[model samples]
Target: MTHKIAVTSAFGVESVTKKELKNLGVRDPKAIDGSFVFDGTMRDVSRLNVFLRTGDRVHLVLKEFPARSFDELFDGVKSVPFSDYLPTDARIIVNGKSVKSTLYSLSDCQKIIKKAILSRLSEDKRTTYFPESGPTYEVLFSIRNDLVTLSLNTSGKGLHKRGYRDLVGDAPIKETLAAALVALSPIDAERPFVDPFCGSGTLLIEAATAAMHIAPGISRDFDFLHWNFFDKKLYEETIEEAKSGEKKQKLPFAGYDVDPSAIKLALRHAERAGIREYVHLQARDVKDLSHAKSHGCIVTNPPYGERLLTEREALELYKTFGDVCKRLDQWSINVITSAKGFERAFGKKADRNRKLFNANKECRFYQYDRL
Candidate 1:
């Protein structure tokens, strides 16, 4: 049976997530706020979880209906055939959010939804209480202006936890956002890629995986793997297909950080990501960045000065970055920073700028292409 799936992403990367869905052969992916919806089979669920790079989580959309009152909300949730996807032994966890909706009590909404699901399942299993000692099925709900959308969480942990980066440095960029930064740049397998301010080396690692066409979720397991209805063999086949599609390409990628400890952590992360062989990492300041390759791409997340470094220090770093850019004018530069006067400090305006969010802080990705 075909199912409606919602793939979640960061606010600014809806388009990137949609493109990834399309690349996975999802038909007519619909872009929405913070997510993209598509229709596919259960097999597509496996494919999406295994291959999506920029997506935060994959959810199996269950139902959407208006719920202005508590009774309406309970009835709306109870109408879904949870038995089809969940077994009697399945542990159900209900999470909810309300935005500009009449049923604004989140705890009450969660309680009502949980009770409704239990009532629906009780009829099938003839049990008053579920033992709840089984695989988990996380149900999520969003109520917007009295319309409720419910879905099952197919991805357990967020996709950004790609099983690598067991340790993170200060102000580390998320793996999903790092992948988006690489996808937005003009870097490929053949082109050289560099991240001078490589805190935790997320961008370089993501770039290496992209260059090799490695599925980000290859090393991880999804919540659907524990579902009763999903075929384990199909998931295994999907993973094998992803493995087969990986190409052994020579990726000219380098990452540098001023802190030796950060470089050490980055190298360990690279090793964990299975791209240490393709990536070159060194402990060096951004001001000393130099490369023999011309027209390469430098995609980096610099220090935002929010917690680390003063505003003056961050500005000085940008000035040094400007000097580095002038020395390597042939290379394209893509920088994500929350600094207010970034362009003024960088000594030139970006050819293009995109609004992005680094975690909760609003930031801009300044792109300067080599002319």
Candidate 2:
């Protein structure tokens, strides 16, 4: 059955729209605040769980109502056929939020939902222990004024945990944001892509996965599989199908970092992700970066001193990094930084600049197209 599915995107990543949907095999997606609303069947949901790397969570927008009070909220919750989606004995928890409404208490909201679910089951609330066997249905209730939006959390643990980053240091880019960076970049992975300061190799990995159409969820487990409606057979089949559909390709992706330990960790992670054969990792300074001779891209988040270096040192690195871009004039460069006066440091005005949030600090996505 085709149902309304809500996809939660990273903040400042509203740019993920139908283009990404089509890329991820969805027909059309409607972009909303920090999310995209799309229609999909249960199988499609499973496919999304396997294929999508850029989204934070995918959920079924099961119900929405005008909930004014606890009674109305209870009715709204009870109106849905919960037993159809969740087993009577399924282990469950109610997650909720209220905004600008009388139902401001999260505890009260939980009670109301619990009562509604118990009433529907009628199988003795205590006996109906939450089942640990299948996918989980995460319920989200957003109350604003008299309207309430109830959604189920379909993608568990968020999409940023792309299963590849077994080791992450301070201020690593979230996988979702990394995907966005790659998506927003002019990088054509058919050529070559490089991240010079590839700390933990997030950018390099995201690029390779995006290029190869590798499903980000392949390495991780999701909470949705705990729900009664979850079909293990279908899930396994989807993974097998996606994997079988993968085409063997040469490595057009590489990363260089001066830190030997970082390179080692990145290589291990790539191997763990089963893509080490498709990615090349080397320990080198950014200043020594050489072109792969083909037209491609350089997308990287240089150290900003907050994690890897001091303020003076980060500024110095950016200064030299800017020089390198100028020298490698044929490459499209996408640089993300939180340092001040980046344009001046880079010695050119960015063709496009996007405001993005990285680990709570506001940053900019600066793009330069080499003519």
Quick one: best lDDT, which candidate? 1
For residues 1-371, could you state the per-residue lDDT of candidate 1 as single tens digits?
Answer: 89899999897877888888888999998876577898998889999899999999999999999999999999999999888887777888999789999999999999999999999998876888688888989999999989999999999999999998899698999999999989999988888889999988999999999999999999997889998789999899998999999996657899999999999999999999998887799999998988887679999998877777889999999999898888788888999999988889999999998898888889999999963
**In model 2, how large is the Cα lDDT of residue 194?**
87
Over the full model, what C-alpha lDDT does candidate 1 score relative to the true structure?
Answer: 0.90
lDDT of each: 0.90, 0.79
The TM-scores of all predictions, comma-separated, are: 0.97, 0.92
For model 2, what is the C-alpha lDDT against the true structure? 0.79
lDDT score for residue 67 of model 2: 82
